[model samples]
Target: MCSTKPIGILDSGFGGLTVVGEVIRQLPQENILYVGDNARCPYGSRPPEEVRKFLFEIIDFLVAQEVKMIIIACNTATAAGLEEARQRYSVPVIGVIVPGSRAAISATKSGRIGVIGTENTINSDAYRRELHRINPRLTVTNRACKPFVRLVEEDLTDTEEARRTVTAYLQPIQTERIDTLILGCTHYPLLAPVIAEVMGEGVALINSAEETAREASTVLSVSQQLHDQNPQPQYKFYTTGDTEYFRQIGGRWLHRDIEVASVALGG
Candidate 1:
């Protein structure tokens, strides 16, 4: 059965735009409905239970919108709620962690990989567990770059402070000489350039957004639910924070003008 319903994507804030961009590129025929919980952004520092609560709230909103699939684009949310969300929701729920782990596993030649994500995600050891589950001998280094989320959310990626922060956070991982580095958090891709510079040519940066989008495409194709007839796909953006700010940042990242509406989720 073919379904034309929009694919729902949720992130703590603007980070998921990375996934949105990939989805637009890979699944251009599919409509997209995105929610960014900016008002309660940076789920990284929050407890697992709290992050799960926020994730379910946003997922409930997307489910009510009748989306065919839901992508939890936030690493922390995925670490906190991916399994539960899959069981709770009838629609297919995809997470950033597994796709990223698979991609990193494929990219690494030395059997050593580095994962950089939020505090909660790193603490949960989601990527480490996923990578090890695939290959027990693989050396997985995990770093919690919590401030990187704030930098991307605040649109400070191009600043010197951002570079310094990136260097500081990645220094330990750099010394480890991991052959592949997973940009575990969706937001971390926005800082790819600086991270690349700091980590140098030896480390391959794996952006989860691209892999996640590919996974979404594969899932829809396998299930025969892909929207193949839509030539002009519609996109809807909602944010719990400032609409204009989201529009501005999202437009800059997406390289096109986007219409954003303010939405308040949960009582």
Candidate 2:
């Protein structure tokens, strides 16, 4: 399928739009369909089996939309469901982990990398595996920051509570002598300043959303799926939970009006 068919991206919540926006910026002529499982978000907090089940339903929904490609924009979903989704679909299915992992490795200065993601992502050891797979001698340090998701969803990324919580949770990883830190979750990028402040000026923060978007562009190019259309491509957003909240937060993040259509997902 060509890019005219629309690329599908799924996130546990509003975070996936970070990746969607990047893709649109890079591939201006491409259409995109984004699905946010807001009804069952914080997949990071759920059991692995539950995450997998939710992802399957979402994947089926996207595939039925006749999307040409699928991006598992949620790190927890990628760790728990990417492989299964890839095998089950005929389209080119991609996940954020490998692309992000490779970018982290390439961006590191001392071969020491720190990763901060959701609990399930860290627990799955997905990033560590890919980082080490690329360079066996690389040092990887990971921490699971659970409350950050809530902080982001509640629009409290820069609040005092978030500040204290982030600082306390990340204090140990700061002194680990790591030069590169991967924001494994898209939601984490919203806290980049606080993270940079806590980790100091020297640590380079690699955003997986940006890297993952680049990967999608490369894949479409290689597969001859890149759309050659001239007209502006439209983006459709859907949420299984609160459409107004999703639109408000998503518009704030994307710096544009995001009209979210109601969806029934994860049943």
Candidate 3:
């Protein structure tokens, strides 16, 4: 893969823009190509095998676009297919779980960390496993917030419904008295305000997007794949669903105009 080729990112839907934003902030010279499988979104509820299939489809599409690296920006997809993806693809494949777990580990003061994600992710026990792998002493509390993804996707993150939903979904984790919480799903970061309100000021919320972007930077730098010359890097977006909706949600979330094209995956 060429160093100047765009770095590819994919998610179940628009949630991956959080990672895209962070990458842009930290690695301004690098180009980005984002794909949101909006058609098969909320991979959190899907069977592991189905999620894995969709992930490979997206990865194949990204690789054809000649991305130098790939970021599985969806927690469900990451949990489902990260290892297989790394083995299947030549470029470095990074997932949100490990980075999120590491960030939660570093941010927690009480060693009690709470994690929230989609059903598939929480059920996969990926975060719990990664956290224990790093520090076996940690007390991990996990909750699957299924409705949270819909709230963010619908751009209802700051609504009253969003606040009530956040409160209900996070209350279980709140009782655990965790000093740090991992927004295990990339979509969850958009709901950070309501989540922070419900969890109160004591818990530090770890957005895996930021950590994942940093990891991508390290991988590129160490491999001499960093694109050093282009200050005006281009960004391309594709969706396996509604292009118009993708453009709208993506533009709103990223605070920039997004031109999206539709793609067909799993052919």
Candidate 4:
């Protein structure tokens, strides 16, 4: 793959914008092509095999677009399909879970880290596995906050109900004495305010977005695949569902409104 070719990224929906924002912040010179599987979004609740299928579909689509590197920006999809994507695709395929796990390890003071994500993610124990892979002695607790995604997707992150939901979902983790909490799902970062409020000032809320970008930088550097020239990065967004809603909510998520085109599945 050419070094100057756009880096491809995919998420279940608009949540991956968090990852895109971080990439933009740290690697302004690199180009990116992003896709959100909005039509069949919320991969969190699906069966592992189904999630894996969806992930491959998205990755296949990105590769068809001639992506140099691919980032799986969704926790659920990463849990389901990252390894398969790596094996199936010729290019490097990276996921958010490992980066988030490493960040949690570094951020935890008490060695007790809590991760809140979708039900499938928590059940799959992806975070727990990776966190233990790094430090076997650390204590890890994972909970699934299924509603947070809907809240963020609906732009209800700051609502009173959002506050209540956050408090309810995170109370158990707080009582567990976790000093670090991983926003395991990319979508969860948009609910950081509510999460922080409930967890209080003591716990460190780790957003893996920046860490994931760092991983990308490391991979590119180690492989001598870094893009040196300041080329204008092209960002194309395709939504399987409502392109208009994606453009609206997603533009807000990125703090830069742009056009969103429609993408078909199994085409």
> Which residue pairs collide in model 1, if any?
none
Model 4 agreement with the true structure over 27-103: per-residue lDDT tens digits: 88788888899888777677889888888888888899888899999888888888888889999989999998988
lDDT-superior candidate, 2 or 4: 2
Summarize candidate 2's per-residue lDDT along 36-144 as a digit string, tens digits: 9988877877887899899888888988999999999989889988888878889999999998898888888899999998877888899999999889999999999
Ordered by lDDT, highest first, the candidates read: 1, 3, 2, 4
Error of 1 at 24 (Å): 0.5
- Judge candidate 2 at residue 212 and give its lDDT: 92
Alpha-carbon shift of residue 225 in model 1 (angstroms): 1.3
lDDT for each residue of candidate 1 in 67-176, tens digit (9 for 90 to 100): 99999998888888999999999999999999999998888999989999877778889999999898999998999897997898778999999999999989998888
Please write out the lDDT profile of model 3 over residues 1-267, one tens digit for every residue.
Answer: 338999999998877899999999999999999999988877767788999999998898999999999999888788889999988988999999999999898898899999998877888899999999999999999999989878986779879999888888888887888999999888788888889989899999999999999999999999989998997999999998989988887898899997898899886
TM-score of 4: 0.92
Listed in order, each prediction's TM-score against the native is 0.92, 0.92, 0.93, 0.92
Go through the candidates in order and give each one's C-alpha lDDT: 0.92, 0.88, 0.90, 0.86
Q: Which stretches of candidate 3 lie over 4 Å from their true place?
A: none
- TM-score of structure candidate 1: 0.92
